[model samples]
Target: MLGAFVDGELPASARETLEARLADDPRAAARVAAWRAQKAALRALCEGARVSGEDAAPDAGQAGAEPAVLILRPSGSWWWRAGMAAAWVAVGAGLAVAATMLVPRLAPGLAPELMAGAAPTAARSETSEAFARRADIAYAVYSPEQRHPVEVGAADEAHLVAWLSRRLGKPLSVPSLAEYGYTLVGGRLLPGNTGPAAQFMYENDAGERLTLYVASSAVDRDPVRLLRDGNRRTFYWSTERTGYALSGPQTEPKLREIALDVCGALGGKPGQW
Candidate 1:
């Protein structure tokens, strides 16, 4: 019933009754909120990808340039929207796997260089940079949502962790940032460079949001690195198991501190350099 309300599929009379119930039932209200947030997150991800693809395509008027083709046939059909969403999920999974495969070929000397204490450089594989940039973009797109910032609220921490863990095929945990005055708002599953990714969001009392993006990667060990795109700052690193990127509009020092907390919570000890 709440799902139908969230999707706008409820009949007029049914919708009114649902709204009346939601007005009184806190649990139902929370479920409705989660559903709405999930829907908005999906729309944001799809639109961001669509806009990015369009921006990258060559102009149709350019000599020998082929026109970009985007299928916009979903219109208002729920089935078509669902199918398109599934297709996008598959595309993301495939891209992530392809990137994982290319990491070795693109940077054959990466492991040795890292072992020699060299940092990732301009010569690093495009896949690493893409993953970080995508994390930044996802943060920018979803963090500012007023009504629906997270697909699941922190109250459902166990289920959120379990669901994302299953999707990513790895054990997952959410770190506590209470020491920094930010509590977990919740998390959602996203597309990663080689497979499924998970994003956990935290919010401070001031309403500031920070996101931690976790994904599986071929590159196992990398130094803690800071990346800045526009006003956002990200501290990203990788372990033998997975890669992590924490992004927000916080100061460098603050983000670094939080990153260390995250690392400690995740069973790592990243040196401050």
Candidate 2:
């Protein structure tokens, strides 16, 4: 191990490990110093033994015996080699960092929309907090109305579904909350953060209401998420290229129960809840 270190034959990590051991062990450090000194002496002896020709006479008292023929490298050459290797590694890391920071800045002509899928930002993926807030706002605006709560009444359920599916660029289905005691009142068109949104409203016997807001989502899939606004709550998730936010005034436990059923009916995974 000591010979490999002196010859610079060990890999960097192994060299570092051995170096640490040497620093803490006086006997090991002594061995390294002795090896270095011995190498220097051998290199000096080899250089001084150099002669003009192979036919030269042997030294005075050593006649008929071979002269010193060992070839030794200078002690400092290994350190020089190690320094060049480290410099090359540093240069490679610098190039990688520069590429990451400069590539996008160099291409100013690329449209933001064209790069949307390549680099999805928060704008493309609206957070659950914003989704829930929008559902709450839509419900607050329309739920109080008696005659115009919806743009299309439930009497034309088929038309409303078809119209919404076309506007959002994806097929949509409304899951009945009737089992949880709310009946569908109707649905309407609304503006979403990124595109057109659809809102389907429902009310129970006591007139308390809920709204399911949906829009085109870049998010392929996500687990169910819940959000709370002062007097309201929302259970939201993204699935099958669409985002759904259900807002109501019910407690979290009650709303959670209703949200799971709604999720199952809309083909969302049961484990997501």
Candidate 3:
């Protein structure tokens, strides 16, 4: 009995039964307590405080969620490992049952055409937030690094447009940023969690860089939305043909100014693109 418990070979139902029996049997309780203490001490020595109960609880009632399961593999000599295999199999079966009851929700729905999956509108909001966070990360990645700033620099105006147009599936042109004291730095193809996108970068003589990430709507979207978040500003709008997003650390007024110029230079329809 002591050996099975030490090896954690008892099934959960059997363990529960033994636990109750131990409460009534002082000798069994003493042995279990000693074993637990030794296990805790070993774990503490190996993993430090991180193995402590500091894990935050996951959110409830989310679809496509899966609970985490820990598997303990047999690690002794071949004979010992063979002896433990059956015990681990029982534990694995128990975990499979528990997982059916406690599946985790998917990561906030950043997939293309989620409406086809019939997800709720609320879930869509979470997806948008996730994208915004990703946009910030994209900005951070390209904002630095002077040498490899853009894939196609401003000097190759014709080439930049041709490449971006082929990648974005749209006719793209480098909007004149001279008025804003910025020139085209280059452009690149960025993959979003939901779909593919195109990012066109620009730079001013002061060396400030701005970027535009363009992708078509992954879901049915509103006509136009302008979001200014802290140092990052986003101008997002969906037309019949495509969706456009201009994001940067510029102010709302400045972002709008650049966006209008981009639209005009692209020959995009007036009002919004």
Ranking by TM-score: 2, 1, 3
Off by over 4 Å in 2: 1-105, 108-124
Q: Over 4 Å off in model 1, which ranges? A: 1-126
Candidate of highest TM-score: 2
TM-score quality measure for candidate 3: 0.51
Output the better candidate (2/3) by lDDT: 2
- Hey, what RMSD does candidate 2 come out at? 25.7
Regions of model 3 farther than 4 Å from truth: 1-133, 219-223, 264-273
Q: How many backbone clashes does candidate 1 have?
A: 2
lDDT of 3 by residue, 19-63 (tens): 788877766777878986875555444442232364632332343
lDDT of 1 by residue, 185-243 (tens): 99988877657889999999999999999998667676678889988998887776688
